[model samples]
Each structure stands twice: as structure tokens, then as C-alpha cells.
Target chain A: MTTAVRVAWLAAALSLTLLLCALSISIGSRSIAVLDVWGFLLRPEETAEAAVVTQLRVPRTLIAVVVGAALAVAGSLMQSLTRNPLADPGILGINAGASLAVVIAVAVTGIASIMFYMWFAFLGAAAAAVGVYLLGSGRRRTATPARLALAGVAITAALTALVQTIILTNQEAFNEFRFWTAGSLEGRGLEITGAAAPFVAAGLLLALLLAPALNALALGEQTGAALGVRVRRTRALTFLAVTLLCGAGTAAVGPIAFVGLGVPFLARAAVGPDQRWSVPLCLLLGPAMLLAADVAGRVVIAPQEVQAGIITALVGAPLFITIVRRRRIEAL
Target chain B: MTAAEMPTHQARLAARRLSVGYDSRKVLDGIAVEIPNNTFSVIVGPNACGKSTLVKALARVLRIQSGEVLLDGSPLSQYTPKEVARRLGMLPQAPHVPDGILVEDLVARGRYPHQGLFRQWSQEDADAVDTALRRARVEQLRDRLLTELSGGQRQRVWIAMALAQMTPLLLLDEPTTFLDISHQVEVLNLCRRLQREGTTVVAVLHDLNLAFRYADHVIVMRSGGIVAQGPPREVISAELIEKVFDLSCRIIEDPETGTPLVIPQNPDTAAKGS
Candidate 1:
């Protein structure tokens, strides 16, 4: 597609996402009119409706947007780095690593707060990424897609086993672990968003800087190197970016499944495989998908909300399958 | 300008006692050679004779274990990757093409070395891409997806991408691999055209006859070292073929081009005839 057309599409997508964000903020357990929501947003007051909008819905919406974009962009980078369409934080053991760490924090410190567990999650995610890289690359060999995928599977299985053992041994920790594992975007305040923002921002900035190199990398490592890309350096930075994005997102919202796996395919379908276009598209589309799903979670049960993670899985699984079946998955 | 006006264009590529290897085994050991400017040079040898390794070393894709590759009288390692890429481009054997990538976009990626952090997609990039597409004869297929093109057309598009690099030197490893005879000729003809336009072209070729017909200089290798290096007509002979390939062969002149052609003799057939 032409650049002008792509820019037009991006603009349309951004507008639609903004509309969805408004809908998410206005329509919750208590439905407020769009005008009232805007009035409250524009003018501060001590009214109950204003409090709901400012203290509750606004923080939730912001967290959803940030976490959603982080996961989606991280997923896209993972797929491009591994050259595997199926790659994501969940698939690559990143989320499992975070889950294990969060479980351990709860069991050891007896602190069930999401805020406190966030740090451990980031540490676990970074460690898992490094482990995967070392195992996949091995001695004297760069990580190929097949090798990376296999390494991810091994790490994920091991981490899941450890997490299960911790939860099973401690009944008190299991309750918190169960809720966190379901991946809800609830009860999180602006503090969580503030804490995760810098990491996510840094990751997004690095991703934008590396997009062109990632595009060349999709051609192959040797081809990327020949194109003047520092292949080893790009790979290292990509791992760091994915770590920051996924670590922060997983910490803010519990291991939200499928957003990272499914969103990139949608972005790639819209903008082709050029990372420069696809990564930005994912940034916008991811928040849109997450906010829309969060809205659905709030309304589907009316008065009682399902977690946003469940809604995304319900929507994302069939879409992912359709994509895989509709076209032959290209070999990396 | 004409070739006589320029006289000898300084050698842009040279290797000094370079050694390269993978894992623990050495592939090319202490071999040195220089590629003359504006010449279509072909490296040929039997399977696993390190012809590709030497090409890879020259392109800086393979790290030299000893000595250095010199570009314009400076060591290759001293220059940044983008600096080297600005002057040299390499087309690896069987490069992967991303699914659903348009031809023009793939060709445009070759401008990566010239693009900067803040400056990208300039008019010069556009012009280079256009010239490359026209020169490689893929302008008509620029909008098509790479997967949709035929083998010959795809190879030409890849050449167009390398051409878009706008480098003085180009190295291709088995550029004609997996193509039919006609497509092989088509790619070779494209390389010839590129050489004519003053691009130094070096390729690792399996077909000795094709190398002889197309290459201005031929480097023959055996067991990680140069067996002979000269103009194809002077260097290619029955003795060289037998020594390099471990096969008895008769060297005959081609009727069309008068380049040496090796026709291997089967020992059983020779004994029966005698």
C-alpha cells in the first residue's frame, strides 16, 4: 500500500480507538452519558459521578491502554525477532516467569497487593528472557526460530511447574494467585500505571528505533547483517525491549493472554510485514482491542464484571485459528 | 568516461593472509587475493572447497580469524558496518523473502545503509530504487508480491535489491542456484550488465563453464586455498580441472565464445574405447 493510504488508515484507527476509549470510560457498572463524562473530565468537581469517572474509570482505562499497547508491541517484536508467527510473551515463558515470581512474592512476604508483586514480575521476566536467549543461541550458534521456540517451551513448562508447586503448597497464596492468573484489569490505580509507564515508554521508543532493522531481520540474520544492521546488538536490544514491555504489562494486569499473540497478526494483515508500520499500528489497535474487550466484560454480566483477560481469550482464540488456517504460515 | 581514460581503477577489495572458519574447523586458511575494480570476478571450485567462505570473508559476513580484508587500502574491521555496506553489498545464497512483501519495498530496504536516524526515505533513495529496478528489469513487477513471482523473476528482484544498495562492489554467493538453465543465463546476463556499468561483481559459481563465459577473472580453489587465479581462458585447462576437481577431463573451446569447457572423461568409457 502507498504511504498516504497507510497514513490515512492509521489516522482512522486512532480516531476509532479514541472513540472506544471514551466508551470504556463512560459505560461501566453505572452508565454515564458521553456529555456528562466529558463535562466531568473537563471540569473537576466533588460529585459522585465525577469521582467515578476520575478515580475509577479513568485510571482503569489508562492502565488498559498502556498495558494493551505494551503487550501488543512486545508480541510483534517477539514474532519478528524469532521470525515465528506464534511467538508471544505467554508462549515464550515470559508471562509464566512473571507468574512464578508473583506467586513466590506472595508466599514469602505474605503481601497480596498487585503493586508489590510488580517488581518481582519484572525481574522474573528479564531473567526468563536471558535464560531463553542463552539456551536458544547455545555455544557458537545464533538462535534460530525453531531453537528459540523449543527453548521457550522448555522454560515455560519448567516455570509453570514451579508456580504450580508454590500455589499448591500454600492455600493462602493460591487465592491471590488464582485471581492474578485470571488476568484482570481491575483494582489497579494510577500508581500502577505511573510505575509501569517509564519502562513501557522506553520500550516503545526503542522499538520504534529498531523497526527498520527488524524489517531487515525478517529477511534473515545474514541479510540483516549485510544491510549494515548490527545483528547481535539488534537482537540484544530487542530482548531488552521485549523484557521491559512484557514485564511491565504483565505486572500491571495479570498475565493477560492472547492480546500479545493475536494483535500482531491483525496489525501485520493491515499493514503488511514492514515493522515500521506494523508496530505503530499494533500500538493503536492493541489498546482499542483491550478497551473494547474490557467494556464487553463490564456489560456482559451487568453489575458483575468478568475479567478482560477472559473476554480477549474468547475473542482472540478463534481469530488466531482463522488466521493460521486461512493462510499458510510462512517459514521464518 | 571510457576505461582507457581511467586506466587502472584502484583495487577496492583485497585480503591479506585471511583465515576464516566456523565451529572449530577452518574453512579458508591464510589465503590472500585482490579483486580488481570494474571486473566481473567469479570464484569456482568443487563442493566444500571454501569458495563461498572466501566470498563471505571478503564481504565481511564471516569474521576473519587472522589477517584482514582491505577496502581502499584500509582494514575492513576499522570501518563501521554502515561504512562498509555503503561501498559493498552481498547477496547470500537463498535469502529468505518475507511473506507478502511487495517488490518495491524489498528493493527499497537496500537503502538502509544510507538512511540515518532522522533522515529516511529520501528522493535519492527513490531514484536509486528506480534505477535498480530498471537495470535489473524488475520495474514492471515492483508492485507484485515476491512469493507470486516465478523463480527467474524473483532472482532478478533480489538483484534489483542489491543494485539499489548503489555500492561499488557486489558479491553474490550462488546467485544462479536452483534456477533452470535459461534463468541462470538471465541472471548472468544481468550481472554482465551491472559490470558494464562499472560495478565490481564477484560471485561464487558451481558451473565452471558458465564462470568461464561470464567472468573477467576467475579464481579457482581447492582445499581452502587458491589453485589458480587469472583470466578464465588462461587459467582453465585440463590439468587445472583434474587437479582442482579430482576428475580427468578434456578442455575444449566453446564454439560460441571460445572459452574453455571441461568435458569429464569416464574411466570405464576410456578403457573400453582403448
Candidate 2:
């Protein structure tokens, strides 16, 4: 681990992400050539080959990259913020919160418009995060990481149960929710990507700025304060950033598991617990993972398709296991 | 000394009628103490006597229930945390080490108060970190991970981090508690050296003899109140130890340094009150 090697890894990962993005656009139900994909990317034409590239594959590829990066940032931030190596975006029920809101929207209006429900998902995620924070912050000023995690688990459980009951009773809601709960990128257009990307961008900015402070926080709460970090305010802002990230990701695609949980560990294993390095590395690694999974899913069963979320867990869990077996996990 | 050379100065670091507590229970109340400039000061007391509370309150780790702490002749509350951090550094009791963090990087974190988003890792920060590593005698372990270091080495690295803060005044809460006799002495010696190097050092120490041996100024406490303050030789006596700790002890001289040393009486002779 020299600086040169780390920089090389970053460059390689970025190149891999770009390669995967290109591959996702070309290798799909139609398997367009690289040259044709390039032409379609520059100026989508009237032909059917171009239609597959322009109308369908490109938007999903963009959504996959954006949501993947957002989840990765959210997961890394959540893990460090809670100081729980096991922590991820779903630990605080952001996914469950968004899922519950979307299901409620479907049951009420029977409309599946991305624009209509994305806002509800975002609000629900923020509300759940705020609720967990309120419950976790102790009677006084002490907000232990373990206490906060327990609060998250509790809220996530309650909201998930509510979502399950609502969807089970409403047949139409269940049919609509089933597609999303499977975590597909199919049929999601650029409008969904457009609605989600700004929040993710804002979150990524906040997370990068919060990086050095999170490094100090790895030392512990009292030590963080001793190092002149404003512990309470920093944690609050971290919550806000995580909310935006997880809310937007889960809103755009259904909760894409494994990328958020596994990629951060990969980032930390390559580097140490320095969030300055881990956070940025995660941004590159996350999308590379998701788009690769998305591309693989388009032909995993041939003519039939698996969702990107299913492929990620199927591929990611074993990859995670293999990685941990090779390299010991870093302590938070 | 010339009259102009030895001029009058106010105590830049002092607490006035300070009260601190968690929840409703008060740990320290109406306590006042001043750290002499460029000297090592130690606060010693029985368990639960609020010495740690006093140090933490001064460090601004604990919220003051009433009154105020002043640093550089201004109320500590007036300065932002980073501004206060520029002048004062503290090491909390048994501070945790981030897993897999390298010694140099850990020391570099002391630059937080000085760094902004744009001006990270300036030349001055690099020099400060190097100086800290050399001064704390951890330059040899600069590339070592905290998990690989021995307890004494880890403590020294932590001190290096505080030194890297490059503050004029340093506060440590129970710096020597978890160490063996030799490690305890090692940490205390480092603190004393920092004082000699012109950094004002304040620490809460549990070992009465060690505090007396190392501290130029001492504050003794009982039940959250300041019992005595001044040089350890004048402030600590057999009567004071008995009154404060309920232990019968005799004061003797350290042959090497001629500092006051406390020798407790045998249990057969002193175990009557309980």
C-alpha cells in the first residue's frame, strides 16, 4: 500500500466502471455492436437497433450507475457513522421507509408514476431517519453508536411489517410492489434517473466534505471531540447525507442489496478506515459492481431475465465471502 | 531578576466557581483551579472526587453546569471549538484507537483544528506531524499500525497526536491509569518533558507519589471540592491524606528526587474507623 498503488487501483476501478457502463449499453436483449452503441450514444437514430440502445438500455444503465454509487456512498457513511462493521444503508430502515411510502401511494392512488412516488419515498426515508435519530440520541447528549443502531433496527422492523400487511391485503398493490420489491432496472427511464441524481449528487458532496471528520470519528466520540470535531453536529449532518443517498437510491430502484453492504468493505480493505480514501473508492467500485451485475443479468438465463438486485446478491455475497477469506476485515 | 524581566501576568487558564455534572447528579461544584504557565500541574484525589471531571470540563469535553472556564483571558465559550483547539489540546482517558490506522496518520489527525476543506495537509502540518513524531519518540514507529504497538508505544503515539496539535496548553485525563509501573512513569516523564519544552501540561493522576514527584503544582480534591492547592510538598500531608482518603499514611521523602512520598500505615494499625 503505497500511494502510487492506491492511485493505480482508483484509476483502474474508474476505467473498469466506464467499461462496464459501455458494456451495459451494448450487451442486452439485442447485443448491439460497440461501434453501433457508440454511434447511438452520440446521436440516437431512427433504426430499431438504435431504439434498443437509446430508448431502453441507456436509461436503465444510467439509473444503475447512479443508484449504485448512491447506495455505496450511503452504505460506507452509515457503517462509519454507526461504527458498526455490519452496518449498511438498510440498517436504519431507509429502504423499508421508502418501500412503505411507495406501497401506501400505490394503494391510495393506484398510480405507478416515478415522479409521483419518488417524492413520497424521499420524505418517508427522511422521516424514518429523523425518528431513529430522536430515539437513539440518549436522554442527555450521549448518542452511543450501538443505541442508534438498535433504534434503527426497531424502526425498520415496524415499518417493514406495516408494509407487508398493506401489500398482502391489497392485490393490485402487491402486483405493482412485487416488481419493485424484486429490484429491477427494467422499464425505468431517464426521468427516474433525473429525479434521483441531484439528491445523490448533493449527498456525495456532503459525504466527501465529511470524510476527514469521519476519520477523526473512527477514534471514538470523546476522542473526536478532543480532536476539535463537533461530534453532535457532525453526526446530525451525516444522518442527513445518508438519508438523501439511501432515499434516492431506494426510490429510484428498489433496495439493491449487497452493493451498499459489500463494496464499502472492499474499499476499506484496499485502504484502511480513512474515510477520505474509502469513500471515494466506494464511488467507483459500487457502480462497476452494479452495472456488471445488470449486464450479466440480461443474459444469465437467456431470453428470460433476472433483476439487477437479485444478481447483485447472488454474485456479491460469494464475492464478499471470497474477499473476506483472502483479506481480513478491518475493524471499525 | 530585573523587575521588568519578571512581569505580572494573569493565569491564562483558570476555572472560576465551575460546576459540572451528568443528568441531575453533580460531580464537581464550586471548584476553581489555575494552571501555572509552562509548568506541569496534576490533580489528585480519591475515586469519584471529581478530578477527571475538572480536567474534562476544562478541556470542554463536559458541559459546564455553571460558571465558566477561561483560556487566554477570554471566556472559553466565546471562541469556536477550532479556535480553542488551536490553543489547547486534550487526551481523554483511555482513548480508543481506530482500527488499522497507521501511527503517522493518527498523529496527522491532530491537524484537524488547523485544516480547512481547501487547505488540507499544508507544509506546516507535515512539519508539525514530523516534529510530534520525533518529540514523542514514535518516529521509529511512524509506519506501524496502532494494533501492532505495545501499550506503552500506543500511549506514546497518542501523546504524539496531542503534541501534533501543537497547542500551548495540554490536558490529559488519567494518562497513566492503565499502564504498569514502568509505563506509568514513562507517560509521566513524557508529560514532564513537554512542560520543560514550554508546553503547559495539566493531568489527572491517580498515584499520589507519582503526582508529587512530577507536578510543579498540585490540586487535591475530596467530595468534588478543592481541598488544597499549591506545591505538593505544602499541600499534601499525612493529615490531608487521612482526611481525604480515610487512609492513615506517613509522608516521606523520595531519595532520588527529594519529592514527598506517601507511605500508608500497616492495616493492623490503621484499620480502626471502618
> Which candidate wins on TM-score?
1
Superposed model 1: Cα runs more than 4 Å off: B1-9
Separate DockQ for every predicted complex? 0.68, 0.66
In candidate 1, how many Å is residue B231 off? Answer: 0.3
Model 1 interface CAPRI class: medium
DockQ of 2: 0.66
Kept native contacts, as fractions per model, are 0.62, 0.72
Q: What are the models' TM-scores?
A: 0.97, 0.95
Candidate 2 pairs with clashing backbones? none
State residue B79's C-alpha deviation in candidate 2, in Å: 0.3
Lowest lDDT 10-mer window, candidate 2 chain A? A323-332
Tens digits of per-residue lDDT, candidate 1, A268-308, equal 87778889998999899889889989999999999999999
The worst-scoring run of ten residues by lDDT in candidate 1 chain A lies at: A171-180
In the range B1-274, model 2's lDDT, one tens digit per residue, is 2112322246668888889988788898877777879989999989999988888889887789998898987888998888888899998886766667789989999988898888877899999999999989999999888999988889899989989999999999888887899999999989988899999999999999999999999988999888888888877789999999998889999988888999999887656745
lDDT of 2 by residue, A1-332 (tens): 46787787789889999999988888887667889888988996999998888889989889988998999989999888877766776777788888889999888889987788888888888888888877888676565677877988999999989998998899765786778877899999889999999999999999999998888777777778877889888998998899899888888888888888888988877887778888889999989989988888998886788999999888877876786587554557
- List where candidate 2 sits over 4 angstroms from the true fold: A318-331, B1-9, B271-274
